[model samples]
Target: MKPHTIKYAFWGAAFGICFPLIATFFELWMSDVSLSIANVIHAHSTQPLLWIIDSAPFILGIVASFAGKKQDKLQELNTHQESIIREKTESLQKRNMILENEIELRKRISVELEAAKIEADSARQAEEKFLANMSHEIRTPLNGIVGFTRLMLDTEIDDQQQEYLQSVMRTSNHLVAIINDILELSKIKAGQIDFEMRPICSNEFFAGVMNTLILAGKDKGLSMNVSLHTSLPEAFIGDTTRLSQVLLNLINNAIKFTSKGSVTLSARMFDADFGTRLRLEVQDTGIGIPADKLESIFNDFQQAESSTTRLYGGTGLGLTISKKIIELLGGKIGVDSTLGEGSVFWVEIPCAACDRPESHAEVIRNQAEPKSLNAKILLAEDNEMNRLLAKSVFEKWTQDVEIDYAFNGKEAIEMLMEKDYDIILMDLQMPEMDGFTATRFIRTEMEAPKRDIPIIALTADVMSVERKKAFAVGMNRYITKPFKPEELISEICLCIERA
Candidate 1:
């Protein structure tokens, strides 16, 4: 209740208690009057009436003194209660004001936090765009580095010059590989990678992976093998390129870590239930990872430890990419290792059955020869240096091979319209038009005869998704930059032969 309302209640209660005593006093006065009248009737009226008037003043005085005392006590209590009510009201008001201020402060803080979040999101988007542009910029030149390197390796040169060029070529390829892996990791982090599943011939897939892994394995003095159940399907609908990368990374990691023992890559049917779940294992007899360090290996840019990182040279992206690719393909991967005994990394995925399984397995063999770029080739590159390097590489490789150069996609289209070429080396990023748009135009606008030429992607951006994109854009082959001369030549030879 309000402060004044409480005072009113106390005052009203004091008045209510006084009413009974007031009535008693009224009755006493009436009795005294009646006796006075009675006595006056019986005796001389004038003699007794004087005594009553004289004592009346004294009786009124006594009653007034008693009422004054009672009223004083009641007023004292009212004053005390009023003081208490004032103090309590003041405290309550202060507390309420404080709470109101706190609420306002919290509201302000919440608004600031929301603003910070919005700014952070905007900054993040800008950063991503910048990184993507840089990726494209770096990739344009690298395409030429590897493409031209391959063309150069096939040329006639002194052994000493060939060896020096080989080293340069190797380093470039290595840098390109690292760049590609980083880009792939970025794509995975951004959740922009798309996976495509189709009928992948297991034997042929293993052969490709094995061919890629052998040189690295041999360099480390390591031996690698592939073992799979014969009952497995000849072809399964899955991301074969990703699966190959997954295998390639694991096997390569094995080769890197190991010094003496052979690394065996074994695959078997772990579980058949739920439609062809297979367990693929890459067991290495190398320096095994500690039990505690096993989990950290899958994290980005993280290795077993600092000491281990120094011992083994890598950006530590292979396993991270491998793990992501496996997960993208609807699977899981893990590691089992001991201190010195060995380590086994494995992945398991669901594979859909192919329509018609091939009856005979192609013989497992190694194709290490670099692709032959001696045939009439058209290189569609935007950067002048890249174009020059590519042209020089072709000129140096085969003296008589016809090489048509285009600085942009538009030039490439004109060249294509004018002359027939055996293969087209196309770059995904360009100024006038990108490879994807140009490829689409070539496929949709050109006649069947014009569109039939093999188009190989010359890029530094090599990821599972990018490869799928190359295929999507009507590219017959996708070759990452800084590639080995042998690998480049082999890819071209394969494309030309297939075409």
Candidate 2:
């Protein structure tokens, strides 16, 4: 079979032959009867016996040689297998090392990323604090400017002086609007805006919005048209104030851009799983936005054209605020425009059908109507000019009502302790003790009438979070500064009546 096997066979045959000769010699040497080697070799008893003995030696030798060869081959195979196993182990160890290094690198990267995020968050918080302080500082002096201007406007004055005062008021209002936009954008970014859901009549809401915006439309020689779908629901539940805000922005934009032709306000409702989906649109025949710029126009501080900012004066935050407000109300807003023809801005809001008639304006109208409260009231304001403005307005609005003033929250608290006032107009940012602390003390520490006395927050901090904080600290109502005289009177009356 194999060369080694053949060699083993040959060796076995030689051994077989040698073993007999050697045995014959040994037998002749040891035996007394066998004197010659020939006689010893021929001394077998039978032919079969001689053949068996001879074959047995050759077969045993062959088998032993084959067994030894097999063991050698098996040892060689085991050695090769061990080498392969060692090589594979070395390869696996190298791969594991690479993997361990990569894992460590990723861990370091993750740690660095987390540190960066923490630093970014810290910087953002610092920026918000700075803005809040700036808003307070700016609005404080602004209240004096707007308040004194209004007071001067009310007094007897020459036509030229009156016109100048009115211009000042308009400029002040513009500045206030810009500040409001910045603050409102900050609120949206901070997720501090909350929507109040209530019943609304689409028709009445549209009418009110049109009434407020028509003068601008008329001034631009543009006709205002309203088209309401007959199938639209009479009453639906949604955030009326936010909806109004969105419509005001759209309509104001329409009026601001249009040189001639008409601005159309329209509404329709569609069936939805939630009950009804209302779509409101403001279409204008104006200098339309370019197709590519439609989406960008809604971004903060963006306009349809760069030149639009120079031509039309605005903070450019209207659409951004409107979009955010619509989104918060569970809606989407979009615009379609032809660059030279016109633009149509639309919003879709999901609403629930309401069985009751819409009465959103009724409560406010009734509460805000000119009326005699004939109740004692205290106005706590730190600014002297704002203080006089409030006094004059309160006196002008209410009949036979005794009003008192306090310079700060501490003074307000002291005045409350001495007298039984029906309500206290609390200003938020005041010296010695802030409105929140004073309100807390009044509610928790004071007794009876003073403790339970209705307190309205009247301050220049118009941020929603600040308003929430004021309410959280026992303020009954909230009103921002540089407000309308009518609004302040309404709040005072409502608070007193509620108490």
Candidate 3:
């Protein structure tokens, strides 16, 4: 019951008691009875009036009990809601703690991954730097050795001396090949090798490769043969140097492994929309490769087996370099082999046929050796042995050839300031000033004739970046160390003539 309902009940009881009293007073008045306070009080003392007053307390008690029960229910509901709220807050705190921990763990992993990446990058850079330094250091000494050996070979000597010098030359050549293989593999991985595409006569190209490698096969008592398809073109435009490198690598590998049977080089051409697709294969009755290992052999520094590296005596980079070179020329290379039989390494490359067939006269001109030169030359070198070797070779190759020497690039600059030489052979690495700076000074700062003088870079650094730097700094030509005297002379003559 509500307070308002209790109030209404009390008012109703008062009204009931008053009504009875009023009714008694009216009856007395009608009966001519005296109307007084005492009389009204006696009139209110009735049964109905007493009953109404008595029920008032009970109604109020009932209303009070109902109100108390509603308040109790509200208190109980508030306590239950508070308990649920506390439980939810605890659960949320626990979830927040877990999420924070996970975020911290992820941050730690990210930091570790970044650190590993940095370490790997540093190691790679260190490796490249080491290879570059080793290449320069090894080639520097090898240049003198090979150069002096060639000079000795040219002189009149007994058969024993000739044999000894030839052996030294061959061994030095092998060393050069190994160094080149290492450098080439690095270049391929770094994506720095540039191909020089030109027209090449198929017949002449094959002949030249065979002429250089036939003696090696003959030494092993293996017959070398070539088979050309009739549909093959006489000439094609491609990277002749890289093509020859691939051919030589395949043929040499075949010859090196084969014991007795023939090593055959076969070629054929298929027509394509762009031009002709040439397929060249080198088949040999060599130690055949395992089926599982054939693909791995084309990877850098990998061979068919560890035993193969020990017996074949190679860096295992030849095939890898060959594959990369072929791919650069837009070709694919593969091998087919059996366990007891032989192996066939094949490559297919697209080539554009030459507009005109290569002439035999052009071949004669290319094969002709450089004639005796009677020109003044400036040789800038830091090493004493290299200086002596170059002077000896120049003297041996020509008569009345005046050659001047400079120990470093600064000295070479001073010499050029004094005298005008026909050609300048500049070395890249030196103590005071490097060759690149000196060449730039000559080209940009010096006077007309001196600045315009033919400058050929002679350095042991054979990286593509070094070569590009040489030309970028105004060097007219570049020659790697351990170079043949004939090639150096030819480069000198060509530079002088062009100038």
Candidate 4:
């Protein structure tokens, strides 16, 4: 039926017909018959074989047509298979391209995120450095101001002059407190706060804190009381400094708010599944917080009332810092108040009971009356006013003490090389050489007695890292700026006694 099949059939029929006619002619020639069409027809008509030969053309045509149909079917099948293969190859290529594009996009996002993280870290480091520098610059001048003011108060002056100096001292102290609060909050937010686990005597700790703050309340014509429960342990394991800080903030707040009535600080202990828990409460009878706003007061820079800031004049970070400190110590803090009567703030922390340490008693006894220090001292300071303040303070203490002054760490080192000094009062920040390097040189490069001399770090930097580094460089003690003259003298006496 197809054209190829018809062509194959026609060629097959022609070959068959030619073969039969040739055979008939060949036979006639062999038999000596006339080689003509008439003879060939007679030969074919007479022979049975000739009749069979005559049907060959038709059978051959039918066979050739079937073979041609099979060939055509095979060609069609091969073309269809090739088409399918081409489409599948293209699909695979497109999918691979899309996958590569997705991978590239993810790689770019990862790079950008890494860059952002690096930038943020750099900025935070820069901020910390700036704060450290600022603290040093501010505290250096404040130390001289406070020191000179205290000395002035001791001299003969009119009542009005005394009043003015006292007010200046108060304002300066308040400013120092604000600076401390800001630095503490920054350390907390940066996760740099560390707590010490040591034995703390309940009575001694509470007594010390009360002694420091009771004067403030009494000056305001208010009574301050401390009540410890009988069941409370004599000593417990906790961070004494951190606990004192929290208690100071709470008691100070209590005294600040209460103008007419008394304030009370109380503590008790209870058993818990984890350990013994200590609960501290500060109660004040003053202008109390509103019922609706009590919970929000602990938030940073937040107060119970909007106008409370103007009336009280505070940064409002006290309670917020206290809350953060308590939480970091694995404790909780809360407050309860009425509108008009009073308010109570409480803190609970887990502490295990421990025996009263003998070392604490020894420390208390040693603090009684420091022996007079009559020795040669090296004072290394870069500030002129600070140097004059130190000289005045020492002159007031005793005439037997001889003090030598060095303008910088380099001068101090040079003085040490030439003379034998009993102690070195070192300042951390100085030109030409810093205290850390000088101390390191003394400890590592100097001879026996000079290397072993007591070195105290009298610095304005209050960051924990600075303190740690000071000790690491062989500093015997670290005292911050604006320190009391009595405290400095006592430390000097102690260091000399130890040496």
Best by TM-score: 2
Question: Regarding TM-score, does 1 or 4 come out ahead?
Answer: 4
State the displacement of the C-alpha of residue 355, model 2, in Å, after optimal TM-score superposition. Answer: 3.8
Relative to the unseen true structure, what is the C-alpha lDDT of residue 232 in candidate 3, on a scale of 0 to 100?
Answer: 73
Tens-digit per-residue lDDT, 1-499, candidate 3: 4444455555555555564555666755765758877765554454455445545555655565565566666767887899899899999999999999999988999999899989877876686778878999999999999999988888899999999999999889999999999988888877778788877777777888888899899999999998888877887788878888999999999998899898999988898777679999999998899999989999888899999878988889899999998888888999999976899999999877775553544311121333446679998899999999888887777766788999888999999999979999999998898899889999999989888999999999988888999999999999999998878877877787788
lDDT (0-100) at residue 395 of candidate 1? Answer: 54
lDDT of each: 0.74, 0.81, 0.84, 0.88
**In model 3, where is the ten-residue run with the lowest total lDDT?**
361-370
Name the better of 3 and 4 by lDDT: 4
- lDDT of candidate 1 vs native? 0.74
Output candidate 1 Cα RMSD: 8.8
Q: Considering only N, C-alpha and C atoms within 3 Å, which residue pairs clash in candidate 1?
A: 146-482, 155-397, 370-486, 370-489, 370-490, 371-488, 371-489, 371-490, 372-489
CA shift at 462, candidate 1, in angstroms?
5.2
lDDT (Cα, 0-100) at 133 in candidate 2: 78
Error of 1 at 446 (Å): 9.8
Query: Mind giving the per-residue lDDT tens digits that candidate 2 earns over 300-343?
Result: 89997788988988978999999998888788999989977999
Ranking by lDDT: 4, 3, 2, 1
Give the clashing residue pairs of candidate 3, or none: none
Ordered from best to worst TM-score, the candidate numbers read: 2, 4, 3, 1
